[model samples]
Target: MTVDVDFHHGDTIDAVFPEADVRVQVGFAAPYAAAVNYGSDPHWPPLTPMVRWTNKLGWENYDLQEADSEDALWQKVDNRRAAGDPLPGAYHLAAHIAENGTKPMLYASDAFIEASQRGEKWLEGRGYDAETPVVEIARDFANWSLELANDNLVSRVSAASDGNLQRSAFPAKVIAK
Candidate 1:
């Protein structure tokens, strides 16, 4: 038996998990607040409501679906905070984010998943255990998604009026690439 794999023709964005759902961590913790206040563009203001709630009531998980854009993500965060839940201090809020930031594994694109499934079939036909290869493929997808997020953060930070290249967590030039 022969299996064919398509990685979506080098379209990394769509290839990762277009059809599958993705959950990302979005927080208004102090570091992120500093990024918004000091690094991001004025037009892209921080979620004031979310910020106020986070500062006073602490943070809560804002679960989002794959279709949700950055704006939609923040809106959900604001909505969740307004609903009122157990509140923590700033330190706790940060700690919670740090601890659970990558939980549930950021989902891979549907295309990536499909390709990996095919890869697994191929491996099976070859009398090999698919588990290792599938896991490796999933790890690659997760890492790629992470890199994209990190680069986007740097780009946003550098775009801010008050943003200084030296202050960026990632090199400003690399993000532009």
Candidate 2:
């Protein structure tokens, strides 16, 4: 939700060029950005932000479909908290979020998951019973996503060499003049 604050796309830079040393860069000017992305070790964030976030989720999401009744989310938060439900179906999620921070819901997108699965597919194609493992389901899986992407890129280049590099669609004729 916070990646592209104010619709400026100011947080991350995505670019790809062979001549360039790097193709992708993701960072934030705001100091709190990193904390939100990777999460912090169980610390209390300000309650006001938590309250605002709770209220925001309680309202109409427009086109977004929510499983529970939208208007009752905030109303049930206090009760859910009292009952010790950490998430409470997204109702008291803000309270847990304030105290424990959060996993990177956006930092590591589906691309990372696909890349991770690619390895499993490659092994399966070789007749090995391979599994992608449980990294994606782990608590710190977000951090591992980046590592997986890096590993996939390096291995692809090493395995195929320049054969994987982009080639021109048109071919040059070898006919004698």
Candidate 3:
């Protein structure tokens, strides 16, 4: 049901990645993260995170213009703080995800897979194998996510930030197995 990932990244996963995990594994920490990649079962998410997101980044300048001005945009965003539905660019509100769990994002999966293929092309003939025990089982995941997910001419960022949630991963080991 769940695969443990002994993982850690700071602030966010930036261009540099793949830092020697002698024991490779899988598993997701948050429901949204998994849902974005492989969908999820029905669940009610706490509205707090959404509100925090709005508070933190809702007032930033967008390329597209909205109703009247930045003040108007912020006012509009404030109006929906209770529901925390974000307004897309051009002053358009993104469709509310509703109370139901999010659907898997096919576009992200497609992009991720495409990125994996690119990694394979380069890893070829490199003969780089850092004792990956789960390579056979999760090769695509390891190669695509761990090996490459950078920008077209760059490595992709992988880690998810808590945003205003303020919590990040820290070193720890399970006392009881």
Candidate 4:
């Protein structure tokens, strides 16, 4: 489901989403590994069932105060790494946040229909055929937007990152295809 895009008159994404907060990173060579985390900043919430369960196992920073403390926070991070659950560990991170009632979010408009339409129109206006598909970075908002439109943002991101274990961490139910 790859789409080919052609840029005419150098009209870029910034032109299309002007007045929208967007950031683009361009590099000469692709990196060997990749990771991107964009969402609300996470803070430890008041004790919930999940927190209590984790605490029973004696994991550090199980209490909200410990997690909230600057000194204890890094220690908790280190403890997680030692336990093989690393920071930016997408699945664990997402699950933890979901437990606290704060879940990852994808703005429907940004990552779905509107983006696709805007992309197509942008290309068309630049002389590309209306049917020409706009190519986007695999993990980018545009690509995810198109996938989300098809109700596969979770599976797609999960597949690319290894498996759907991280998908389970999302607070929302997986939409059946």
RMSD of each: 16.9, 18.6, 12.6, 14.6
Residue 29 in candidate 3 has what lDDT? 41
- Give the per-residue lDDT digits (tens) of candidate 2, residues 71-163: 454445555557775543233444566567665433333435564566445434544222322221221232334454334434432242433
lDDT of 1 at 163: 35
- Candidate 1's residue-wise lDDT over 1-177, tens digit each? 011222332353324444422222222223443433333322333343234334333244346433456577566656656887433233243444445442221112322344455544543554433233332443344343334444444454334323332321221111100
Per TM-score, what order, best first? 3, 2, 1, 4
Worst 10 residues of 3 by lDDT: 149-158
Measured by lDDT, the strongest candidate is 3
Please give the lDDT score for candidate 1. Answer: 0.37
Model 4 residue 58 lDDT score: 44
- Give the clashing residue pairs of candidate 3, or none: 149-156, 150-155, 150-156
Cα error, candidate 3, residue 2 (Å) = 7.6
On TM-score, the leading prediction is 3
Which residue pairs does candidate 1 place in steric collision?
A: 16-109, 17-109, 17-110, 18-110
**Relative to the unseen true structure, what is the C-alpha lDDT of residue 17 in candidate 2, on a scale of 0 to 100?**
19
Candidate 3 residue spans exceeding 4 A from truth: 1-24, 38-44, 59-95, 99-104, 125-177
**Could you tell me the C-alpha RMSD of candidate 1 in Å?**
16.9
**Deviating ranges (above 4 Å) for candidate 2:** 1-23, 28-37, 59-177
- Give the Cα error of residue 4 in candidate 4, in Å: 12
What is the per-residue lDDT of model 3 for residues 1-177, given as tens digits with 9 covering 90 to 100? 122433343432211244423233333344444444565555534333344333345543232233345555456555655566655322221223443545554433454566446645545544546453323323444434432222211211112332334322122222111
Off by over 4 Å in 4: 1-99, 129-177
Residue 130 lDDT, candidate 4, scale 0-100: 28
TM-scores of all candidate predictions against the true structure: 0.23, 0.25, 0.35, 0.22
TM-score computed on alpha carbons, candidate 2: 0.25
Residue 30 CA displacement from its true place in model 1, Å: 8.7
